[model samples]
Target: MENSFLNRIKGKEFIFSTLLVAFVTVIGSFFRGIIDASNFAVLFLLAVVLSALWWGMASSVFTAFFGVLAFDFFLVPPYNSFSVSDLKYIYTFVGFIITGVIVSMVASRARRQAIETKQREARTAVLYRFSNEMAECETTPQVIGAVRKNVGELLGCSTAVFMPHKDGISDAGSDADFPLDTHEYAVAQWAFSNKKPAGSGTTTLSAAKAFYVPLETSLEAVGVLGIRTADGRVIFNTSEMELVTALANQSSVAIQRAVLTEKSREMELAKKTQALQAALLNSISHDLRTPLVSITGALSALSQDFEAVDAADRKELLQTAYDDSLHLNEIVGNILDMTRVESGNLKLNVRPCDLRDLIGASLTQLKDKLEGRMVAVDIPGDLLEVPVDFSLMMRVFINLIDNAAKYSPAGSEIYIGAKTEGNMAVMTVKDSGFGIPSGDLEHIFDKFFRAVKPRQVSGTGLGLSICRGIVEAHGGKIWARNNTESGAVFFIRLPLGDAGHGGRD
Candidate 1:
């Protein structure tokens, strides 16, 4: 609405400029009765200045021609016809047009500068916004998101960001662009590998459907930024092309920041890994030895004297040996789970299974751990069967429930529940334990991730990672977060046999 109003005002100004010049020329014609015909050119020259100042060069030209014709017809000898009686008067028209043209050219120069000034301001604004957006990005995907959004806005075109990979660019799909085909993607690959631009607007590979530019820092070409205009133009104007280059440069710097952040994270992770390795060595010497020593000592005591000990003592010793051996077996089971996940060697024995049966079987196995804890089970009465590896799924539930029992205070309630969400069977395990630390929430399911600070907890941190591996193998999702009231909630969502969302397909 405001734009139309401003345009209307400009239209009126141009019209008034034309009319004002015409009025001045008419007035000059009457005054020529007293003034010299050449002197009348001065009055029309004023009209030319007015028109040029308010409108375009073409309007000024019109004004100049109108003035000369009026002067020749009204003020020159034989004052009514275009056929001038005196040929010397023709010089007046020539001088008049020359003055008008000179003024018009001057006005055009000013207008050009004004337009350039506006464009510069606009470009500055775009750069400022681009910097601010890029500054907030902390990850590679976030940087790509910023580039996608900003490029779409600034360039008014389709855009895609392709990160570097072993073979070529990695295409994380974007809705903002129609994906390039094999030939076009090859152009992008060339741009990235060569650390130069290719495709539509560039000198190289002009036949490509989209323009591809390498997002390069001084260290390396991190990725490629590709764009295609909506107007089907094979090229951009000078300023536009410069803007795209600047965007690529800015994105390069942002991606460089992300790269630096990742390196810093890796360094920190390496440090943690060293500490964990030391911890693992300690655990091997302690955790593995303690149970083995118990089993060995009990067996030795029983074998050493047949009649020296009572039958009750013999039975107790055998039980202790059996229990320690079970403990050792649990530790070995965790090790095997880690091996299976890392080596991708887990083969599932999948079948349609009931959640209630799985939960019951898991709880039966965890009776020792849950002996002192208050347990709540809320499996929905009509829960659907899920396609799963039954034994692995049972282990997942056992680990989760055991983790809950281990972390929570003795006698605190552990809640295990299941319901339906969309086409998924949603199960949750909640414990009244100290919640996961905020920084460590995302890393909980990572293998060997202990809490930031050491704890009195006795087990290796492989339980949740095993659960993650098993659930993912079944095409399910698993995540944990602190509950609002207290403790933490671990959620498992698995598809109900291709009902929707993710499944075997």
Candidate 2:
């Protein structure tokens, strides 16, 4: 607002400088007898000085020229005439003109210096703001956005950042407002290659539509920043060009930092992937070998001493071989299920199946494992049939029951309950066993995760993880929680309607 008021005052001084000189001439005429021509000359000089202070060199010089004409026409001895009776008066006129011109020149130079200082301060402030915005950028695209926004606001022009890639320069999906044509691209390429500015308002390729500045860092040039006004011409003063170059340099540093950060993240991910593969290979080899060894040893003993062993001893050895074979089959099955789930190939054969029948089948399958456990079933008789993949869901119940039996003490009551809640069928398998650690509850369903408790229990830790995958693929949710009194409870919620949302092929 203050600048506008000063501009208005300067405009008035330029437009009315002649009027001021004329006013001084009238005063001189009024006091022609009282005031000598020498005193009148001082009054005209004061008018010229005022013009130089307010309106700059052009207006001040204009005032000085007209003041000379006014003095000769209205105040000189030969009033309103150019003819001078004495040639000595010509020296006085010459001296007056020189003095007026010198005063105007001095004042005009001072005013120009002040204006330049103010403009430099304003440009510095703008550069500070652009620097602050660049500091918050964390990626190449984000840096490009900040550049476009700041440069456009600074110069009232469209802007873009062209980055080098395998195929020369590309915008890298940044939707820049400034479009680069063939000529403009050539100009931008020259700027980037030479690490200098080109195109409009510059010495090189001055006829191009846009101006291009190289985004150079201490290391090397990263890209080119292109600028174009709406009229297809770029123009800037010294301060503005300096500001553009400063922004480009800051952005180049930021882009380099972002690129390095991305590469660091990728390296970290590669290290993690290597570690996970090693862990997987180790776990599979150990689990696969243990059950195979047990089954081989049991069968080898039975084959060598079938007649020598008593009837009861033969039955015990046969049972041991059967159990180990089942264990071996389970390990292979869990591994296959995990592979299918991880590869996104787990398709569901959805069908409406009764909760009681599913639970009964799972219990029957695990009859040997749950031999010493007391099973308590509390499902409502008229409970609605849940839409699910029958085999996948039966496996879910089997895993839950087997896990409970393995963890709990002998003869402990394992409760299985089911009921309808809203549009869902909620089933829970709970056991009176050592509850999961508070920290491990959230990670229990993760692949290869085993609890710290019950280290003696034997099996690969893929059962619960597979169960979770299968349940979720059937459009259901599964979770485990510690009971208020003791032990842990596993809950499964499945949609009771059509299986449209399930992972069906």
Q: What digit string (tens of lDDT, one per residue) describes model 1 on residues 68-115?
A: 777777678787877887777787788779978998779856865776
Candidate 1 residue 253 C-alpha distance from true site, Å:
2.0
What 10-residue stretch in candidate 1 is worst by lDDT?
Answer: 1-10
Model 2 lDDT tens row, 1-505: 2343355576676568888888899889998757667678889889988888877777888898888888877887777797765676577678778988899999988987887788778877887787788788878788888888888887788887888877567654323556667777788888888998998989999998788888888887788888887666456756667778777777788777777787898999999988977988898999988877877887788889888888898888788888878888889988998898777888888887877888999999999878977899988757457888888899899999989888888799999998878778899999998889989999999878898646678878888899999988977899999999878899999888853222242
TM accuracy, model 1: 0.66
Q: Best-fitting candidate, measured by TM-score?
A: 2
| lDDT comparing candidate 1 with the true structure | 0.82
- lDDT at residue 421 of model 1 (Cα atoms): 84
